[model samples]
Every structure is written in C-alpha cells, then in structure tokens.
Target: MKTLYDVQQLLKKFGIYVYVGKRIWDIEVMALELDHLYKAKIISNKEFVSAKLVLTHEHKIEELKIKKLNNGGGL
Candidate 1:
C-alpha cells in the first residue's frame, strides 16, 4: 500500500477493477470499494489505513497536477 499500484493490486485481489478513464475518478472509485471492504471486515485496520493513505496521497497529487495544468504550468 505504498503506491497507487499497490492499492490497485489490493482491490484487484477482490475482483475490484476501477478505471474511470480519469485518474481522479479511478481513485475515487477505489476509495469507495475500499470503504466497502473495510465495512465488511474483509480487510484489517492496518491494510485499510495504509490503503487510504496511499489513495489520499495519490488523489492529492492528481488534484495538484490538474490545478497546475489549468494554471498553464501543465504536468
């Protein structure tokens, strides 16, 4: 859960594949799936927290990139 790829692999283990054609959208969907898994007690607290940290970090990075692109700096 150190990277987005790790988070994706975790989700994939449960047959959850998310690709909404946009990085932000995909991360959002993955968050939802993670929430569901956590609620179902399918994942441990440590795994949930680690995955969330990864997702949140990645989401922020994507948001920053979008902001930069809109501001004319671009990625």
Candidate 2:
C-alpha cells in the first residue's frame, strides 16, 4: 500500500504520472494532478495512450480512472 506521501513523492518526479490506487482514496489527488496537466496542456493524446498502456500493465484493479477510458472512447 502506498502512503499518500509515497504517492506524492512519485508524482513530484514528473509534472504528471499514471496513478494507481487501491481504491477511491486517491481519486481526488489523481484528479488534481490530471487537472494541472490539462490546464497546462501537457496531456497529449499520445501521452494518454502511453499512460493507458502503462496502467493496464501495472495495475489489476477495475475501479480506477484509467479503466474508465476503456469504455469505447479513444482517449
């Protein structure tokens, strides 16, 4: 289990990252990160593609945000 601090430390490495949380506990933080990236226009379609691939390979959960992208939209 990643403590909030651990997650924060990982996020600090880059302005953005693919967040993998065990549950909804980190949704707000992840949303804020994505929000910052979106506001800065740093999230490109290609980055989304890459992030999705990484998330799928690294995570096994179905409730996270990345899984939401598999619902037919081409993120």
Candidate 3:
C-alpha cells in the first residue's frame, strides 16, 4: 500500500478492524494481522511487504509525534 490509510483499507477488505485507543498500537496490530494473513496465504508477499512498509512508516511518524509532544513541541 502507498499509505497507512491504504493499508487500513486493505485490512478492512479482509474484515479486519483494529483499534487500541492509540494510533501506533493500531498500526502494530495491523502489522501483526497482516503477518498472519501473509502466513495463511490470504495475501501475496508483495502485498504484505507493501502494507507492512506503510504501517512501519506510519508507526515511526506516530512515534516521532509523541516524542515531539513530550519535548514540548506541537504537532
């Protein structure tokens, strides 16, 4: 997927929805679910890798946002 939203949409297509009251946690859950789907052959390696990349990128961004906030910087 090109973006986190795209990854979320892909997961939704598989009837997977995850929310843990935190964006980073949600992304991590999505990544784990994607891993399961990949292992089950429900998604191709390319699709899994793409979605994982998006999720990783989003997770990093969220972490940076949190760090910024903790450092007294506004997002």
Candidate 4:
C-alpha cells in the first residue's frame, strides 16, 4: 500500500477494521493483524511488504509527533 488509507482499505477487504482511539495504536494493531494474515497465507508477500512499509512510515511519523509534543516543540 502507498498510504495509510490504502493499508486500511486492504485490511477492510478482509473484514478487519481497527480503531484504537489513537492513531498510533490503531496502526500498531493493524500491523499485528497484517502479520496474522501473512502467517495464515491469506496475503501474498508483496502485499505484506507493501503494507508494512506504509505502516512503518506512518508509525514513525506518529512517534516523531509524540516526541516533538513531549519536547514542547508544539505544532
């Protein structure tokens, strides 16, 4: 997937919807679910790798945001 929305749509195709109140947590949960799907051979390696790239990018962004906020860098 290219964006977080694409990853979410991919999960939705399998009847999975994740909303953990926080974006970072939601992304983390989605990653776990994606792993399960891959392990079950429900998703191909390409899909798994693409989804992971998106999730990892999004997760890093979220972490940076959190860190900046904690450091009083205020957006």
Query: Top TM-score: which candidate number?
Result: 4
Candidate 4's TM-score: 0.96
Rank the candidate models, highest lDDT first.
Answer: 4, 1, 3, 2
lDDT of 3 at 17: 90
Candidate 2 C-alpha lDDT tens digits along 1-75: 134444444456675454555444354545457456656776665554444343443344535455677775575
lDDT of each: 0.95, 0.51, 0.91, 0.97
Top lDDT model: 4
Model 4 CA deviation exceeding 4 Å by range: none
- The order by descending TM-score is 4, 1, 3, 2
Among all windows of 10 consecutive residues in model 4, the one with the lowest summed lDDT is 66-75
Cα lDDT of model 4 by residue, 42-68, tens digit: 999999999999999999999999999
Clashes of 2: 0
User: Per-residue error at 54 for model 4, in Å?
Assistant: 0.4
Candidate 1 wrong stretches, greater than 4 Å: none
In terms of TM-score, how similar is model 2 to the real structure? 0.33
Model 1, position 27, has a per-residue lDDT of: 96
Tell how far residue 66 is off in model 2, in angstroms. 20
Q: Candidate 1 on 30-71: residue-level lDDT in tens?
A: 999999999999999999999999999999999999989889
